[model samples]
Target chain A: MNKILSTVVLMALVVVGCVRQDESVIRIGAAGPMTGDQSKMGIDLRNGVELAVSEWNEKGGVLGKKIQLVPGDDQADPKQAVSIANKFINQKVAAVVGHWNSNCSINASTYYHTANIVAISPASTNPRLTQQGYKTIFRVCGTDDQQGGVAAEFVLKTLKPKRLAIVHDNTTYGKGLADFFKQVIENKVQVVYYDGIQTKDPDYKAVLTLIKEKKPDVYFFGGVYPEAGRLVRQAKEVGMAIPMVTGDGVYDPTFISIAGNAAEGTYVTFGKDPSGLPTSKAFNEKYTAKFGAPGPYSVYAYDAANIILTAMQKTGTTEGTAVAAYITKNSFPGAFGDISFDKNGDVTKAPYVVWKVTDGKFVEMK
Target chain B: MFTQQLINGLALGAVYALIALGYTMVYGILQLINFAHGEVYMLGAYLGIIVLGVLTYWGLTAYSLVLSLLVTVIVSMAFCAAYGAVIERVAYRPLRNAATLTPLISAVGMSIVLQNFVMLAQGKEYKNMPPKLPTEGFNLLGANVSPVQIFILTASILMMVALQLFVAKTRLGKAMRATSQDRVMAGLVGININQVISTTFMIGSSLAAVAGVMVTLYYGVVHFSMGYSAGLKAFTAAVLGGIGSIPGAMLGGFMLGLIENFGASYLSSAYKDAFAFLVLIITLILRPSGLFGQKAMDKV
Candidate 1:
């Protein structure tokens, strides 16, 4: 009797394992520079996917099975990103959620294409990302063109400054945004003092000095917050505060810490609206309850994750091709708003909100 | 603009000098370049920011800055000193007689471990440093002189002077210098080589703590990975001046900083790091022994 019971238990265990192995649950791989200089973006991006996947699994995951999210860190290097992509493909993941930067994503895109897998990016905004119009490439966030148009419109109408000076850090994202914003707003405003600063440099006093010489009515920075913060604080110290404006890239709490009081009058353009959106109220409450502090990018990240899950639900399949097709063909409501992708898999809903650094916080400007 | 760049480079070079001291000192004695030196700098900054953040959160506004700075130095130095000594005994001591690359690999591993440890303790977000030495500027020589910059330079100088005195006047200082000159000879002369090595590591790590604190005060922010960039720059400074010479290390750091600032201001700001390394390459090709290092007769 004891031997019989043992065999029965063994059979039950084997059946359970076999059932688990048969369907091959929705396994998604995410990669980013989670352990290097530009790691914050990867960490933030993973947090979005993690929060979404965990929630999906708890709610009886896609196709009636658990979802597994495999994370690989690229450490922000282009070479590392490609290697990570090959690893993800080897694992036969249903989809991939990474390569945060354009360089990394661009390198990994070919690998994902070859593997017959769809790669969704939450952050990489270079226009060249989906220019090939690959069936598998999708981006949840607006591209530099969308963001630049919004910024140009804001600079043209809201601020209405007579002259505009653009400074970029010369990265793919930075230079792209600067060039697009310059082209759009150059006719509307007097363009002066166009320049590029390096990211690793600790000082920008000369650039600030040149801007002072040009004395544009407004200075628009197309770079990350690290350099922007230095420029902002130094500009204030040297008394060149002509209402410095920046893009969505520098719209984080780090800027406030870096620039201090000088950041108070600064403005940045981003797609997400905080405290102004009626639809995001529920998300804001849940997010604040879970995370102690509320960073600006959480909403977009959550939206990206939720939209991915919603796409999976729509197709009723974890197959990358089917899901990607469904995602581009339909619209879905996410924490940010309704997300609908264009033919090139870019988010069609383009809305830019202006935020002012009021009292060391990103307060809604309009 | 030149004056501002010069001053900025000087200030930045001073910070690198303090860190390079640790790298230079450890390399001088053990010939083991502690890869975790950057992590020590990072840990020090994090400790300062965390302590001050807690103080501010607890509403201890009056003495927050002074108290946090004092505590940050003590705690960070204590932790890093222990880390350095233990790392030497466990990671390096086993491979003491092994090929040089073995110890270098161990040091690199130690760096990875420390970075990951710091990441887990402090989330990946950038922490805001407490307000210290207010962001007020005084115009001097047509450059907007930050009183804050003045404080940074003065404080860094005092720390270096104090460090120099510690090495020159203290009992352990002579032993360390003796060991660096010739470890086996010092051991034969009735001095404990291990003790001297431990002492050197302790001193280098302690200096890194001071650098970490000052940098946070300067940047008004700290990140877990802040040490990597600063550490690379400082290591370059150490090599640029002279790998084993203290004064050379200091000179290298200041020179690197000046090059970076001048390059950023006059040349391309985006290529500042490239410019710094270009200078190093030029220097290495021209003077392999560094600015102050003496060229020795070839054994051949």
Candidate 2:
């Protein structure tokens, strides 16, 4: 009877301690694919969140409380993303900055909406993500319609190929982007070949051989780096010397390294190059010093976290609905430039630009 | 187009054959499907990357590409052989006398363990292999045949031939055959069962390692999860051919590759993987013992 009484007292004390500790810190959630093919990008986004939280803590934090970041790995799967969303809700995170993949963002946003938690995806660009009427859902990146339209315009105006071949990896992001591209170029250009390849299969020679026979003037791939790298390399091996174009998914240093010489002269569409701006200089230096180089979505994730933090500071509360309302009403200056969400929770201005791989680096094409 | 697709199939089949040989050899001896065989192949590719990275760092690749490649392949094969032996001893040896299903489960557990181990050690990103060979090759008939494809085909064939000769001629080979035929009788006849089993794993792992190296070189990329799909296909090949027959494995590998490529070329690329499994299902229904497997009868 004495031992049981003491054990019950100890459990009570531990629970109280946890509740007390949770009260003094504002918890922000960061979630993405931390242990799969897209992990590098996920880690980059997480690091951006960490940097923002640390900077806030050093400056006495928001609402006179220290900031804490809770990281969750969704592995780029929709089902895993829903579970991660539930975990974040259970943890009582004020806001979430993550879910790089479009499908994951779309799936998890419903749970976040029900829990009244704000989710600001830094990389997911599918337009339907914002069109679902979830007031709590937001993103800092350009939507796929804008990005794909820019890529199509560039291909039609600059390359002006007579025949085009479009391929996708059949994921939500890839297929969505490819569909947007196809919509723009549907009647303008003759789509000699269009198909979806299984991602991570690592053998695209057979498919590339089939595409080669079609004799398309240019090729466009709608996928992330892992598949795009191999597809481009295999395309070169199959004697297809035509130029290849893709969207923001292929914007990474890993893609260049994977494709080697085949990466040269390839075209990629992403948000305007902010690294050349003066506002981004300090962030770039600090990020590069800590984690080699910022990935494609690093700055966007940093800006997303900062937006949440600033909104909380301005509202003087960590409540999700209030912070989200503040974000929609105003603009926040960031490393990427002025960021303000429209009524649909997308960035007001979609600044998509064409970048060419030149001499082993992504150089903005005029 | 037909000729070109055939060449692609052949190149792909060569790697599958090399990996299938490992699966078949281990199953022949222990009658336990070594599901971890694919992880061994993945490790071989990583080992190749490490060795090749070192060679390139030392600038030896610039001095002589041939010598550098030879060293990389040999070192990777040697490391994978030792790794295979260790896995067999640790994961399989204790379960040898247990229920058959027990060893198979252990094989799966080992596969997951090795995959996670590599993921934690090397990271989740794909590692880029520095290209040491020229991508240029001559046009064959109507298809473009790269030098790397030729090397993969030639090297795989040479290794298969060498493995056949080793199994047929060596004294150790005869001991392996005896043990596979009847373990108790072979043990009574003074054949070291444990040593023969270890040797079988070593040889099989070395062949898988060779396949790993070839794949990394050909694709110019390597990832930890690569072994899963490759292993599944290779295991399918081993079963399609008689599981215990060496030549049958080679034939199965090439046939599966051709089926996949031609299916992708003619019918649809989306159903390429389905084609290989379709053939496997049909073959199983027609011949339950597999294409080359002999029907066994229990002795009363």
Candidate 3:
């Protein structure tokens, strides 16, 4: 009786595992911060995936099978994200649309690569995410190096500040972006001050005071909105009236609310606003109508999801390795325009644009 | 430039001093590090933000920003005092007679609970205080000193003075000092040990609350995790001054702020936090009892 029970359980386990990858369904995992301070962005990314998957399934499904989205909340933490990636691997997902944070994505990338699972990020913009030579990892957004270079060129050409001060919040994303910005503008401008502040530091006056003495013409901050907002407000309080610039991290509406009037005239660099693109107008309308209003990376999330599904459909198989290769070989029309991954799995020709905060909202500068 | 940096250091140091006093006082009384003290500081900040948010919604913010701030400070202090007292009762009281590590672990557990509670109550996002503090300032030796900085310095000093007087001149303060010196003996001497411990936590929490309000005004933003770094720095300050000495904590906080700002300005700002620890290690090596700590003799 014991031998019969053991053999029956073994057969049941194998059958249950195989049930998930049946030809009737294709599963894609979406991992991001669904419960922490960055939940807003995570929700937007999830909603984007949902919209894309629903639209794809509506168009007679992919290879005569409905696509299923499995969302995992990593809370924007590296360790948690790795566990989420492991869970997706256990479930044998065909592809993953994930990891809103650069650090989180980087942490989970190795796991996905080792498992031969194709992963695409909607918003992890750090260049190192692709530079690590992971064939299975891809992103729909421009890297910090590209965005930082555009920002530096604009600051040098338009603002033409003689003395520049650079500040970073000491995160992988923040420091990487600032370093890239410095590398591009070091020869052209005098970077009189360079400093790193703690992520949640409540005061920047001391650092701002030091920067004030040097009389920098512009201050470049490479950090997210929370710290960036405080830095801008405190810099104003310290009476340093120079123009402050930051990367895409501070492009959130909350930045304006936190910095108040101090955010006005602040220069920011990000991928050109997809909502305003002619190709994305219909998607943006549909997104806003469905989920209130889409976040900064929602369009990119839609593109990432569409890229993965289109690859699966074009390859006519849910095999992860083949689909990942197909993604690189063909260009797909996405909400942001033509999407193709380069050798490093980075989106090809991901353009950056300058934006200025006028009144209260971000207005793209020509 | 040097003078301006010095002024900046002083202002930043004052905020650290405000927080360090709470850690020193709790350690003095119970011999417990009270790791949960950081959560109390976080709660104080959220309280301040909530009170200000409600006032702004009611249109009372435009009535008088200074008066509104005064109200915020009081409400935050009162709420934090109760919270600190309750934390001691629920978490620390049970572990009081247990092994030393027990209460320390309990404090850590309570800190996590309080952090999650606040995160749930007031969303995990950073809350910004409206730009109410006046940005105008006078040049002091070519350094820009804003009114908010002056207010922080003046208010912190005043609170420290009042605290000193309370500890030195009052009967309750004497009971607290007695309990710190000899808890069993003080209990035998008719002093209510529980009441004294509660008062110590209350006072310490109120001071932390004031620091929270000052930081919120100074930074114009508050977040759930702000306490961790601030609390770490303040705890470092307390140790540098003398773990259980009030004056030592104050001096240590100022020294840390000055050292950090000067180091960042002159040396590398990337190693700013490292400089504080380096000074701490060097100072402790020379004087294990801290700059103001009394040498304790092992009883035979």
Candidate 4:
């Protein structure tokens, strides 16, 4: 009787193990911060990927096999992202669409590269990500250099402040972007104050107080929305009244909500606002119908998903090597516009536009 | 410029002092560095935010900001005090006579558990308090000092004074002092050592809660993980002040705040956190007993 029970348990284990990877479906992984501070962005990315996959599956699937999206929640953490990458590798996913934060993508891509699994990030923009020269890594968004350069040009050509201050959260993304911005503006503009702040620091009075002494006309904060909002609010409290500029990290409406009245007149550098774009019309309509409204990265996530699916279709296989090769050779017409990759697997023409927050909305400035 | 930076340093130091007192007090009593003490402060800030958020949602913020802050402080203090007592009863009490490493491990475990618990309950995002406080400030020597800074400084001093009086003037305080000197002897001399220890944890945690609330308001945001950095700095302050000395902890906290703010202002902002640790290293090298700490002679 014990031998019979053991045989039954072994069969059960086999059945459970085989359930995830069925022969009829091709698995692709979607990893992001499904729950946490960045859950909205993660959920938006997952929705976009799922929507793209479902649309493809409805149209007779990709390469005569149903596309299945395996979702993993990395919680926007670097360590968790690496674990998720390992999980995707174990599941034998052909490609992964993920890692909204740059540091997560930078860390997780190392594992994906080792496993030869193609990873296309939707939102990470740290310059070092592409500079690492990994064949398995690709991003559909602009790097900090591109975004920060555009911001610096806009500041120098348009706003043209005599003195400027650069502040960052001291993380890889924040500091990297600030450094990029500084590199462009340092020669033209009189750079007065530059500082790095703790990410979760509640107060910015000390830093703002020092900036007040410097009295910079333009203050660029190279951090995400939460910290940027605090800086704006606290800067106003300290009576600094300077115009603040930031990267695409503050494109969300949450920044305005957090900073309230202080968010007005603040400038943010975004790659492109896909909502009003002619190409994104149908995608935006369908996205709003399903998920109320697409987030800042939803179109990028959709484009990322589409680019991977397109590569798979062109190559006629779910194999990572063939798909990545196809991706490198071909250009994708996406919601953001024509997306092409250079030798570094970075988008060749990652155009950036500046937008100023006017009455709680990002209005593009020409 | 100098005056502005000095005021900034003092304001930052005041919050650090409140948190350091908790570490110093617990260390004074048990000699067990309660690593979980930081989480208590983090939870206190969360409670303050939650209470304020609920009150604001109910349209009570229009009633009065001062009243709302008072309610937040009281509620946060009560909840944190109970939590401190319970943590002592459960995590620390069980391993009372165990190996030294055992309770330390338990404390670390407790810290992680508390952090995750709060993270699960309140989503792991930076919760921002609306711009409720009056942003107006008075100018002193060309430096703007906000009412919030004045309040933080005043309240911290008041609490420190109250704690000093409680420790030095009351019978419970005497019992606490005696228990810390020798727990077994204090127990034989009709002092409830366990009760003294619980009271010590409660007081320490309550002070930390007040600091947590002040920091939440001062920074205008709070996150579940905020405790780790604040706790680390406060612990450093406690050690800098003389780990087991209350006054030493207060001085250490101020010194750390001043060093960090001044270092960030004068030297480089990237090394703001490093300045505190640098001073701590230098102080330990030169005077191992800390600035205000008495030299601890080998008892045996």
Q: Which candidate achieves the best TM-score against the true structure? A: 2
- Deviation of model 1 at A262, angstroms: 3.4
lDDT of 4 at A342: 88
Q: B1-300, model 3: which lDDT tens digit per residue? A: 788788878888988898899999988888888888988888888888788888888877799877888899999999999998999999999889988788888988998888788778887777877666678888887777777788889989999999999999999989989998999999999999999999999999998999888877777777776777888999999989988899999999999999988887787776788889999999888888788987641210
Residue A330 in candidate 3, Cα distance off native in Å: 1.9
Candidate 2, residue B43: Cα displacement in angstroms equals 2.2
In the range A244-306, model 3's lDDT, one tens digit per residue, is 999998888988888988999999998787776799988988898899788888888888998
Residue B61 lDDT in model 2?
Answer: 87
Using lDDT as the measure, name the better of candidate 2 and candidate 4.
2
TM values, all candidates: 0.86, 0.93, 0.90, 0.90
Predicted candidate 1 versus true structure: per-residue lDDT over B153-219, tens digit per residue? 8877887788788779988888888998899999999998888887788878877887787777666
> lDDT tens string, model 4, A224-328?
887898889889988888889999888888788778788899999997677778999989888888887888888888899999998889888877777888888
Clashing pairs in 2: none
Better of 1 and 2 by lDDT: 2
Where does candidate 3 clash, by residue pair?
Answer: none
Off by over 4 Å in 3: A1-27, A34-39, A53-84, B53-66, B295-300
Please list all clashing residue pairs in model 1, or write none if there are none: A198-B269, A198-B270
lDDT for model 1, please. 0.78
Instruction: Give the Cα-based TM-score of candidate 3 against the true structure.
Output: 0.90
Candidate 2 vs candidate 3: the DockQ winner is 2
